[model samples]
Target: MLEIRNLDYRVEARPLFEGASARVSAGWKVGLIGRNGTGKSTLLRLIREEIAAPGKDSPIRLQNGARLGWVAQEVAPTDQTILDVVLEADAERHALMQEAETATDPDRIGDIHARLLDIDAWTAEARASEILMGLGFTTADLSRATREFSGGWRMRAAIAGALFAQPDLLLLDEPTNYLDLEGAAWLEGYLRRYPNTVLIVSHDREMLNRSVTHTMALEHRKLTITPGGYDDWLKLRAAKLAQLESQKSKQDKDRAHLQAFVDRFRAKASKARQAQSRIKMLEKMQEITVPIAERTLPFSFPEPETKLSPPLLEIEDAHLGYGPQAVILKNVRLRLDPDDRIAIIGTNGQGKTTLVKSIAERLPLLAGNRKVPKKVEIGYFSQDQLDELTEGDTVLEHVMRALPKDTPVAKQRAVAAQIGFSHEKVETKVEKLSGGEKVRLILGLIALAKPHILILDEPTSHLDIDSREALIYALNDFPGAVLLITHDVYLAEATADQLWLVKDGKVAPYAGDLADYRALVMSSDREKAGATKASADPAEDRRRNAQARDTAAPLKKKADAAEKSFEKANARIRTIDTELARSGLSPQKMTELSIERGKLEAEAAKAEEAWLMALEEYEAALKESAAS
Candidate 1:
């Protein structure tokens, strides 16, 4: 369904893709993987046509009439219900259903019904709901207003909409970054059964191994597609590299022999002709291309100098949550020794984060006592800690804060360098750092504490595969205790010796491995499905259908028009950017293109604003209709 030909792209003087080409057939799940900054996201933008190819001959194309879909930016906060937003994502279905509602002619009504059935319109709500549920939304969340949810939850809703749309080719970039272990597992199963073509960019090795049919590697400025999953790709790549090395060694030996022969025989008249022939042969020989060595950053978690005793940290019968009324987990008894390595697993909102926070001493216990030695130290890593980093401060400044005030400046710089920061990167401001860099900086700061216990929450979300492996090694080598909460099962399996499950308002040890946990999660899905089927009521459905007919149809039409206008302007802006980037353009032509791009950007912004206004009006009307 997608084909790329001679794709060559450069960011200023740096080349990201050179003569990279790949073809993806319909219905294949392909995983796009490489080290960070290898331009995976850039290739996706090129496919979406938001950024044009460098030349006409270097085209990224999709089959004619093929629908392309990705997770769009979160919608504007509105009174629109989550289900409505997902249903609206399938514009075709929405238009047909609207027409079906207003049609009067018998033949027209029959045609509309036929089309609706063809698209499975009758099951659209259930399908949307299922996707949302798998992504961590509760049953009651479906009818809740979008404004009521946090940004992360809204992002989940956006993901649900994309899945509900079911475009011919779906593009997902690190989809599991926002998901919990349960949600990630559900997504893995969903992608395996997805009917359309899917190309995902991810660093989750487990997902890549289990979900994709093919693995596409971007390396040495080229794209290579291999059959089978990530493990298969690794084996094939290893063999190919080894063979190339052997061939290069043999070629080098032959070249050296030829050179030696030419040097010795060129001065002798008897072998002069042979020497000339040997020189010609040497000149004609092609050099074997050796692949460049990949550089990966190492994670260093310094071991505590003083080993703390057993039960270094303990929470006894603690009720963990925000406050007395908001206790999320109760009767929890957990302890961390100096050498413990534990991984927490559960669905979102099941108190995984809550339990971790309580252990880290970030959250207060509503009831029961928490005890820790006065000399014991804990290093905590969380997404919130990343946000708490001072944006205006340099990396060095953050590291300095973590160290003692009397510590030497050279020692502070040494600590930063130990955690994989260069001299230049140490001076870089926090706001200028990339997501991965920010994560590294946080870890560096955490390393400064030399804590007896480390409590990490989703530490690998922004990390690449190599970096994650580095982390696993670091965690295993560290002398301190570790408590990790992450969706990356690979990391958990590699590092954690004990698995703790937080479910049903309690924390307990799980006897099974990750595979067993996956099975349990899948079985829960089946049970939830059975419950949903058993709970269906025809009377409630009729009432909802009757209410939906009263929604403001005209407002929706206006919103659709505005959305089209915004898309057109955005497309024009992309074309303008492509034109402006062309080489050897006249000054006058460049000026004109720049002016046009400015105008198109403004127009696109205006159109988007109008669309949002129209959408809000329609949502308000719909909410009132439903309430009535």
Candidate 2:
């Protein structure tokens, strides 16, 4: 539990929070959200006691003895192995182990051993391994040097270390940026059963929707608490905004009328009383302030020159990976239509980005042939593209450079504004901008090019909710094909018309949407846990077993759904084969039909895989239930 009263904070004489207050009950999972530069991170620091209130009277308190767990966003390069870093999270246990190792006296060694046993220090390594695996660490990666990893991946290890500590309060700031879809799913399930307070600051809507029980927003220089998940927050905010806007509109109109009357008849003796009465009425009325911003930049991609081209890019039995010896994704058969909005989803290191690169022709498809239309142009946006905006260049300079040399300065300024860069921000160097600002610049450049297709990899990873909403609006109106690889399920759902599941070295159309995928991941994790606890002791309490059983019930339903999907896919495959077998079909028609059959076969294979996985989980659940 946490509380703040009369809180005030500032940076260099600028007030970030003024007379703000907030409350978080014990056991609540609250999401802290606000636009970038609104002091979301700064507020977390204040709560963590890294910063002081402007006055001693201002209060920021947490429950006594509440342990705080926050991973450093920036971990300096170190020679420590990943597992070693996680295992060291438990300070007491680590100290006990050191004491036990060095103590020569029998009694001292015995005491150290007893203390270690009390803390279950023997399983510390295994527990660390579990957290690491949940965060997408492979067995081989456990012993790898932390310095060997990229900054994003090192942060994953840092996050794992926090989870390893098992503190009473876990504070995460944009923890999902480094996670793929699978790791994000694992985290959502982990948070569901978390027996502590959690305050995570994230822009991933799906994560907030699933993991948080409450929402805390820093807006208008005040910290406000709302009791609900992300979806509920949206509903509550929409209603509040509507009411506030309505009141503001009516009040403004009435004030205008009163002012108009006063202006017209203030000095005239005959109408003076009436005008004075109206003035008094207007003065006594309270002012209405709208809850949300009235201004939003509506950004859209430039119209593509070409239109209505089916099969814009196709890959035939391709294998994709870096260099020549490794193939991370194999046997890929895909086609891109003129208006296809395909979203690629999977866990980290599952080749989602690699597949995107192959399709974008940024990398060679190690094996098989790729056919891309000669006339097609692709606008690619990725984190690496940030490097292209050199340090000395300003946002306005980048936008104008992407345009024709003869482009007017006014037009350049308009583009900057269109992309959410303000007059002051336009002059800021690219290196000094926030991550979201850099992405906006890249998207602004992409928009200027008017490409026929857009390939975005985790485009919304660094953006706030407002910027994410803006990007969704843009993509919704974009009249071009989209190939998106993102863990931001919210943006994917809004922008994508089709989902491409990249997993287990295969890319295929998923049979369901984001919701179903989440459920599947949850059920699978539960079943795996159930199997390990299947050998229940006869004396185990009924309530604990019942709780476990309740969680496991969803596994059976998922299995049933998978079975139905498999049957449907098989039937579709047979029908496609029948169509291919038909006599007197035109050569071109047969060729098209063959392609359709291949797709159905792939879908059926995916369905078959899902059926096997579901069956495995259902059987494990049944065994655990029987044992209980």
Candidate 3:
């Protein structure tokens, strides 16, 4: 639980929030929503007391005993094993374990034994293992050095470390950033079951809707906390916008009436006084201020002079990866048609990015034949666009560099303006631009290239919601082939026509909606959850029935076999339950696990009922068969 009272935040003399107050109550799951650069991350730092208030005497206070765990947007892995990092989450436990090992005296040995039992060491390990597995970490991966993994895998380890800590308040900044559909779904489910307070800054709407119970909107230098998710907030905002429009109309009518009176009665002494009073009142009335214009990138591809048939791009028996030692894709055969809007999806390090790079020719293939149309031009927007920009070059200079030599300077400036860069902004050094501005500049440069096939890798990474929507709109209307590798499921759903799901070093094509693809990836976890609950429910009943039947026939043989099966299943259920319990009944976790448990319990109950019905049917069948 945390409380921010009369908070003021500023950056470079610009006020971000003034007199903004909000409370994050215990056990509340809140979605922190705002435009980019609105101080969402700043607010999180304030809550964690990592940064000081602008004023020395500001009244921003955090509740006592509120442990905050934050997952940063960028993750840097140190040289350590994955398991070591995860175990570090329980710092106190690690200390206790170390102390226990060093104790040698008889009296100290007894004390250590008591402490170990009290801490439930076996249960903790089981819980840790379960959490690691859910995040897509195999037992083998746990021993690998973190330095060897990719950025996405490092992010997963960081997230696993935070969740393992089980803090009282979790602040997740774009937790879905580097995750694939499978990893994202797992995290969503895990957050649903979290019991502590949560304040999340994310752009994924579905994740927000499913995980959060409240929405916090930060706009116009103020914070408003409202009940329900983003959709509810949007509805409320629309109503407010309508009300403001109505108010503006009324003010316009009053101004018109006053003007008319002033014009009609200017010569009359008695009426002149009233007109003067109305004019003064109009002067005193507050002027309506329009909201800031939303940033957008609006440009469509130039119509292709000729459309090429068959074999837009083809990869035959290709192996894609970083190097010979770390290949992710082995013998992958892929074909792109003239109009294929394919979306590549998989967990980080699973080769979605490598596959895209291979197609873009950013990396050379180790072993395979890749054929592209003779005249096909490719425009590639790598994931780290900001890093790729020249440091000292101006925005206009960068755009001009991408243009053909025959193009005039005036035409280059005109193209830059169309992408939202103005005269002064065009002259600003590329190093000084914000993330969104960099993305816009890149788009402008890409537009000049006019490639037949466009490949975008996480193009929406730095874009705000409005800009992301605008880019999606442009991509949808483009008249060229596209291969997009992004984690934004909403964007993928809106723009892509086909999905290439990468799993276990193989790509499988799915000819359906993004939702269907998500369902396919999550089906395994859903089935496991269902089976566990179903198998656990009738466990005692079966045990009792087995006990009665064993007494009558093959007493030792049947009893031993039945007991073995019962123990095996019961052990698994107990293990899962222990992990769930250790997650600590936070509001978010409760909502999530309750949802999961409800589904599983429902399925289990249904199966039991169906089994009873089937028993009745089978008895009738036996009677009919006997008669025959």
Candidate 4:
């Protein structure tokens, strides 16, 4: 579906692609993977023709008449509903429907209708809804105005539109960054079954392993396409590297021997001619250029001076929600031991974050007790923690600020270096740092606290595969409790020995591994798709409609009530954010406001969870009623 030959590209004076050539066959799902800042997104832009490859000889070309689809940006806030936006993505279907409405001739109208049928236009809404749901949107959200959704939700809507369109060649860039575990799992399954060709740039290992048919490694300013998934590619790449190393070693030995012979015999008349010949041969020989290995830094977390007792942190009969009526998770009992390595998993809005925040002591319990040793310290890392960073400060400055005022400058620099920052990078301002660098800086700051427990939420979202592997290594080495919430199944599988699943408003031990959860997610998606297909029967459709009408009313009332509570809490949190942004607050005042904001966020989350649960209940009741 696509071909590139000798792609020579440069940004300013820096070379990104130098004679990089690769071909992607039709119907292949290719994962583009490399270290961060290697121009993966730039390659996508070139494919989309948004950026020029800059020569008549530029050879990045899609097959003739092939359509290229990518999400350029989040869907703009508009009055149009989500479903309408996605349905309109299918240009042919939309055009035909528009023509059918206005066509004067009976024959023309018939032709339009026939084309629509060929395109399955009648089921466009259902297909669009399914795509949106797979990306973690609700059925009710399909009817809501795009203006009502957040930027992330709108981005998912745009992705859904792209999938609904099903263009000949699809390009996705880190498509799972905004997704929760369930959504990511659903998307992985969807892409594995996608019919068209896809070129995706992702740091998600699980998706690359499960969704893509091929792995395209972008390294050394070139592309290497390998059949099969990431693991397959890794194995092949290892073999190739090993072969190169062997060749280089043999070549080096030969060169050394030839040089030694020339040096020893060049002055001897008997061997002078032979020495000259060897020297000429050595001069003519080409050096074996084995590619340098990519540098990956290890993550570091300081071991605590004292080991906390077992059950380092515990929440007993925790009612983590807004209040009695709006509890998202009730009677929840969880414990974190000094040596525990736990991963929290669930669908979005299912209380994973709520449980984590409660465990981190960022959220106050509505009606429960939290216990932790008075001396025990917890280091919490969340995406929001990045916002707390001082953008104007340097990496070294941030690290220095976290340390004792009396600490030596050498100690501060050493601390910064431990997080993979060089002396040059230490002086770079936080605002100029990339996402992964910012994550490292935050991790460094977290390490300085020497906490007994660590709670991380989606920590690997900005990290590349190597960095993620480094993180797994670090977590395994750290002598403290680790609680992680992430969509990256690879990281979870590597770092976490215990699994906690948040489902149906409760947090409990998961009985299976990551593979089992993956199967469950795929099975759920299949069942949903099958249910959607079953609606094709006219009698069944009519029966479902009548039953939905009967059961939806009471449930809708409950959902609306929950939504209102959520909105109220959410508005307050926004107001607090506004206030916090204002200048000239005392440190004491800031601390109080920050505390209040955390509690309010937890309240808002609980209310939102309650709302979602009510909505799901309503949908389930409608489906059950219809089936009966």
Candidate 5:
């Protein structure tokens, strides 16, 4: 059990939390939800002990010696391999392994080795690799140094790392933000069967619905916990609110009647006692407090300046990538027109972003042209644009900068208000703005552009549910064409009228909706798991798997590297030997050839030795793989 008693926290003088209390049981996956800046993150920090909860003693308590696993919003990029980075989070396994390797005492080393097996250290790499893959890291990615990955990939690694730790309590903040639908799907399954408690703050509805067994909503400086998922919680909350409102109304009427009795009868000697008693009752009455929902952040995009009928933009056999040589999205034939709402869906790294960039003309197509109707204005919303905002500028300043130079300050403030920034929030520095605020600011800038076509990539990544719903409603009502690429299936389903699937280096229309795609993915995963299980006999499988961990893994890695070098060495010698095989040569040429051959022979000997060692290692791996 976890208890938060008088969890008082404050920002400046304002009480974000005066005295909040919450209790959660073991193994409960609770979805923490609230409006942006409503202290949800702060509550998580207090739970993680990252910050102090403003009380004398610690406000949070965990029974049964529980451990905490927290996924950081940002992590320093490391030079360790992705697999190594994830496995490093399993502190027990890492410690045991280190002790086993370095301890000079045989008894100590034996004890540590036993503990390593107890912690399943031998299979840690494989488990870490699977988790990494589930989060969309490729086989090649598992080997690559973390420093080679982009910030988003590093964030994924962080998520995988925290999951790999498998603590008694898991705190994930927007865990799916860096994930694609598939990755999010994997996460949902992972959390559903998680052995311990989970407290996650995410706007992804599917995740909330599928993983969370409970919801803890922080609003108006109070934390309220209820059983069931987000929708279930909302339904119960609504009913509770309605009941409270009714009670408040009845209480108000009772109080009014009591006051009327007191006014009418207080002057009469016989009725004065009764009136006084009624007055005392009125004074002692407890007011019924009707729960109020948080203030709404309602905003909408400005209508597009231009509208093109069908085929406003068309990409014909287009290929999208960086430069000319690196193509990520290929054979992409997609068309959109005004009134069309298309959501592009695919696994991460399958080039959804690239396809959008190609359609938006932000990146040149590698193979074919994208034809766009003349005078069509495109508003492409990307996180990169948000990154380009001036650091020192205020939210209002960002909007005004995008507006016409002659626009008045009053008009600018109005525009900012229209996009959800109000009062002092408008004057907040760009750097101080929360992620969702920055996203809206970027959207506000786009609203000013008034483009005919809107291309949004992961637009809801930073939005709370309220803001996400608002955006969906606005986009659904918008007249312009929309090309959206998002992992937020809820937002995608709500906003997109048509579905486009990006897969196998091509883009095409998806015949069904997000739900259908989800089913297919789930079925595919099951089939893969089933096939893998069916392929091997259970006892033999365990033995060989253990053998692979003990022998094959190290040997195969060494062998794979050595084979590459051997191939290169042999290729070079072939070229040199072929040159020496020429039929006729001058005496001077012969001398030069003989001398070169001598040097080449020494090099070949060293290469041969290395290659032989590699082959021996590979043979050992093969034997392990084939063990009975």
Candidate 6:
């Protein structure tokens, strides 16, 4: 559906990609993978035709009449209801349906028929609703205004909109960023069954493995399109790295042997020819340039001075939310010990952020008290770290401002260097810093603070894979108690020692390993999935139940009357059978029909059981309504 030929993209004379070519076939699911700043998003934009390349041939060329839909990495909500925005994806179908609805006259019927043929109106709404539900949006959620939702939920709605379009080609950038495990699984299932082409950029290994049939890697100013998943790509990468290492070793050995031969005969007149020959051979040899190893930041967090007692931080019956319309978490209790590295898990907009904010002292709890030990010093890292930095200050100035008054200048410089900021980079203004640089600066300050407790909210956001690994390593080694709020399950599994699961306005302490935690989350999602299926349409359920009750009431009356009539018929049949026995009539045919009627009566009993079960379920649902 899309093709790139001899594409070269550059910014300010620096080449992002050179001579890069890739072809995406119909129904292909491609995972666009690369290190940060290697232009994964840029390549996507190029394929999307949102950005133009500087060459005779355009960066991207699409097949004729191929439609494209994109889910951006960052989404902003418009002032529209979630339903209207998703419905807009199929406006033509909607219009056709409207026309068909109003087509009462025979003259207008022909026009409606043509419109239906053009729009495929009959099946469009079903398809749209299916896509939306698969992405974790319900019919009820559809009507909610977008402005009232958080950024994460708004992104989900945007994703729903993109999928509802059912384009010929779909481009998703980090689609799983704001999704829970259930949402991610649903997307995987949808993409697996998708008939169109797909290209996605994601850091999630499971997502890439499950959703992508091919892997497109960008490295060394080139694009390598391979036909396999992430594991296959990783194996290929390992083989390439091994080959490079072997070649480097052979070159080193050959150089050492040549040097030894030259040294043995350099000063001997008798063997001067051999020496000259070896020297000339060395000079003429093609130099093997070993690839430069990637650089990594080397900051290790300092150990905590002392461990806190049990209940590191506690909330007693906390009620946290905004204003009088607070979404209360009542009678909440949690205890964190010194060794606990807890992961806060929940769906988006389900008080995960509110709970974290209260713990971080960014918000005050309305009802309950939160306690922190006197000896514990807290280090908090939030999504707003970038905003915390002074606009006009340089990177070094920012770090220096966080340093203690008695701290030496040399020590401060060393700290900055450890976080990959050099003397020159440190002098660069904070306003000019990129996202990664800003994160590094904030981490540097946090490390300097060396608090006993660290609370980080989505700390891995905007960080490259290498940076994430480095942070994980540092946190693992740190002696402090860590409280993390993140969507990166892999990171949580690697670093957390405890898990706290929040759902349905309550929090539960989970005592399990990472695998178990995943299973629990999946199980909870399955239960919710069943509930979603049962209550797919609240309005429809109510209507059907009301109609069923109405029909059932009249049927019960008729059934009673039929039972009375059947009792009379049974008495008459018995009398006739007795008379027939005396009259020597066989009466076998009447007996057979009587037996058939009895079987029908048994079937009626079963139907009554089924009806009662349905009614009981309806009643139980009402009883549990308060909990939901």
Which candidate wins on lDDT? 1
Q: List ranges where model 3 is wrong by over 4 Å.
A: 72-79, 102-122, 258-295, 317-327, 366-368, 525-628
- Per-residue lDDT, model 1, residue 410, is 92
The 10-residue segment with the lowest total lDDT in model 2: 529-538
Q: What's each prediction's clash count?
A: 0, 0, 11, 0, 0, 0
Report the Cα lDDT for residue 70, model 3.
76
lDDT of 5 by residue, 1-628 (tens): 7898877778997788867889999989999998888888888888877887755789898776788889876446666777788888988888777776678998888888888877777777767777887787654456455654557888999999999899999899888888888888888988998888999998887788889999998877888899988899889988988888989999999999999999999999999999999999999999889766666676576776665577788878877765342456666776676889888888776668778877888667778877877888888998666665665569888888888899999999988888888878999999898899889888878878888888998888889998888888888777788888888888888888788887766788889988898888767853353233122354654455456445545554665566576566557666766776787867788788767756655655556545544444343333324433
- Worst 10-residue lDDT window, candidate 5: 527-536
Per-prediction TM-score, please?
0.85, 0.77, 0.75, 0.84, 0.82, 0.74
For model 6, name the residue pairs that clash. Answer: none
Model 1 ranges off by over 4 Å? 406-408, 525-628
Query: Which residue pairs clash within candidate 2?
Result: none
Ranking according to TM-score, highest score first: 1, 4, 5, 2, 3, 6
For residue 62, what is the lDDT in candidate 4? Answer: 86
lDDT of each: 0.84, 0.78, 0.72, 0.84, 0.78, 0.71
lDDT of 4 by residue, 237-330 (tens): 8999899899999999999999999999999999999999999999998988888898899988889977767988778888885434345688
lDDT of 4: 0.84
- Tell me the tens digit of each residue's lDDT in model 2 across 109-211: 8888888888788878767777787777654456555754557778888888888787888899898888877778788878878888999999888888888
Per-residue lDDT for 600-622 in model 1, tens only?
Answer: 77777778767755664564445
Winner on TM-score between 5 and 6 is 5
Model 4 residue 112 CA deviation (Å) reads 1.8
Worst 10 residues of 1 by lDDT: 526-535
Q: In model 4, what lDDT does residue 171 have?
A: 93
Minimal lDDT window, size 10, model 3: 619-628
